[model samples]
Target: MDKELKQLDNTFRKLPQYPTKVIQFGEGNFLRAFIDWQIQQMNKQGLFQGGVAVVQPIDRGMTKVLDEQDDLYTTLLEGKLNGQKVQDHEIIESINETIRPYEDYQSYLDLAKNDDIQFIFSNTTEAGIAFDENDNLTDQPQNSYPGKLTALLYERFKLGKKGFQIIPCELINHNGNTLKEIVLKYAQLWDLGQDFVDWINQENDFYATLVDRIVPGYPKERAADLEKEWNYHDRLIVKAEPFLIFVIEGDKKLEKLLPLKEAGLNVVVTDDMQPYRNRKVSLLNGPHTTMSPIARLAGIDTVGQVMKDPDFYKFINDEMYQEIIPTVALPEQELNDYAEGVKERFENPYVNHELSSIALNSISKFQARLLPTFKRYFAKEKKLPLRITLALASYLKIYAGKADFAPEDTPEVLAEFKELRQKDNYVQATLADEKLWGEDLTQFPGLIDLVKQDLQIIDQQGSRKAVQMINEKED
Candidate 1:
């Protein structure tokens, strides 16, 4: 085994040397496959001369593996485009170095002071932002990523350096705003003075970004085949779908600086990301959240299988297009197109997208993703959206720890449901929990009773009967 600097594929030999101008906060497969892949395209087109310094946001990560490979890895993109099968592999060379925050804190902090590092990117997951009151300003590295970021920013400010443009790729809505708020809180907590706060408010730019791509990370199951395909063993090989969308909400100045359009990527920089956000949450994510538990309980395993099944497919297309899309504010044609794209994404043959995996945080998911449509539909029609409502009930029933037709359900949703079930009243137990729904869902007229009734029906008659009952009922 030749364990040395080698390009397993000839793809890396022609890449140009780019300046290290971006500080990325995650070494996960999604960032490598999605963002790095785009950066590679930019480099190839001579649109960007910037490289990325990858930093592991957590303790245990692939920093060592990336370092061993000299920050080189393969990205396997698999999916369909325009009804044609597509699968392509490319080697990414935009990553110049990798660093771990735990092992070398000063090195991570030093990146902040580097004038060349102009862009800050992060995908620290949904729960990344938090107020850690105990984090000290003088600590080698603050416990939270945001705290560490604040320290770095303060250091940069003290050194009379302009603030870097930050774009957090966290899954939460308005992630960059939330991160900026927390960073400001840390600044106030540590008594860093108003001067630093003013500098942060003026010099820094935090743009909220909505990123969409299905990166399944490492393909351990196909490692042997992948090794043969590339003629070398790669520990950091990432697999992702062909579809990618990056919606960045920022001013025109920042948009000019990014120049993502010049690279021919699906990147949108706009003053209002609300339309794109609505398109994603209502069209794609809402149906996903609605369909997952129902499909799982109906003996379907993966999203592709569900789309292929006549009953489930009709439910998605008809129920989603006819019922759900009507409730949204977008034009009918745009909604229909988005719905069709959603269906295609669901039916993507290369992805195994298990319904059970999407069942996590179903309660919050409903509140944030689907509840608005439900409310709007109810308000306009003066009746419940039966299929969407039924999906909600199915989610509650799924949460009640029923034996799913698929593999054993993860305990995340089941644990919360069990705790809610222990309460004296089911409606009070679940709907009144503001922490889950972000507000009292009980306030909605007839929602609590409807959910309770449908959940009871699901418990007694099973998923199929419950769905049939909803579908057959005359409102």
Candidate 2:
């Protein structure tokens, strides 16, 4: 057991208390920097009088460390806002306590019975909301996130408690709907009956949400320096960018309850969040996915580094504005505005976002984020999206291993790339593989020939010089 640190209220004069009104699953960096921080902002304004009880979603988490700090931690926000550096640090006081449900089942159930807890928030990673057939309701805590939530809801139902507005911030599409579906599946599987299902439907509000923030979690490299600067030692310190937006697709009335926008937070409650999702995934995530490989191959280690290089910056800018922005279905001005913000975020000095980290699971990320833009740009303009073609070719080299950063993909993908190292016309074979891609990718107009051309340029000029070609070429 670790010795608990003395309460921080003395160091930072703070609120005495707030009634626990939120039950947040997953005490990870993203939730702490985004959701809990937002709650603290609201509490600061006296717009909200509620606190959060964090449930450790996974067994091995930072709940113990959180407890040591008396559920208090500092969130450091740093990035460019309106062309100037913005930095702020706040000791978040929204968290009332931390609970590990796996350790105590009855205590978890008792938390569910709290009438003041009106909102349920989670960011249990993409794979958290799954159905584990092995999960039994009688188990102390079920195997999957949905199963655990089902038990919590069931406990509340039995006590005649009001349902929570469940908002899931998983990166997966339709997060809340997926979680709600799995909960229903659990209800049927456990023979919890139609009453439970009906209660979940009628009483609970399941929201599909889109969350955007650049939270790089703990500052491992700079932690000592930060602690020295702040005159405090915090194991759970979270580093975040200045920009944040949470878009929830539900009735507008729900906004009144959270009162986030009123707190000067960037929160939107719209009837349809699909457009917002598309905007974020395309303008922000798409660039990261496509640029990481190319930039890393060009000997740039971080997104910020790429932004500093004029040649490479122009290359990426041309691709985003000329190729991607032209194809998005949203308004041109909106896309431009978001793209500007993305550039600022990439140039954030405090956050050294490694290209290697962004390069994780590259195959799936490319398909979801960049493929649609590639397809639309080609189909709409009747010309090959040249930058995208180059990015596609650079991807092969990225997966080949031996870059400064290690490559991590499925075993099968790594093995195939190893085999492709020996095979002739490997690009054709790679794009033709229906299994690797969802379909035969070579059929797209000018895709095969143009990608081959880019591969040759990459080989001759090298990645750094090849990127310089984008600035000179009219195309």
Top TM-score prediction, candidate number: 1
Writing each residue's lDDT as its tens digit, candidate 2 over 1-475 gives 1233334433564885899999999998889999999998898889998999999987788988888778888898887765678888888988888888889878888997788999999987654666789998898988788999999999999888889999999876788898999999999999998888899999999999999998877877987777777777788889889888899998787889889988988899998999888888888888888788888887887888988999888988888899888888899998998898788788888987778777766776677678888889878888877777777888876665545566776555678778876778788888887655667888896787877777777777777777887678896
Residue pairs with backbone overlap in model 1: none
Runs in model 1 with CA error above 4 Å? Answer: 1-17, 82-84, 130-144, 219-223, 356-364, 394-422, 473-475
State the lDDT of candidate 1 residue by residue for 373-420, as single tens digits: 888877888877777878877766655555554223324445666788
lDDT of each: 0.78, 0.83
Worst 10 residues of 1 by lDDT: 404-413
10 residues in a row with least lDDT, candidate 2? 1-10
- Cand. 1 TM to true fold: 0.85
RMSD of 2: 4.3
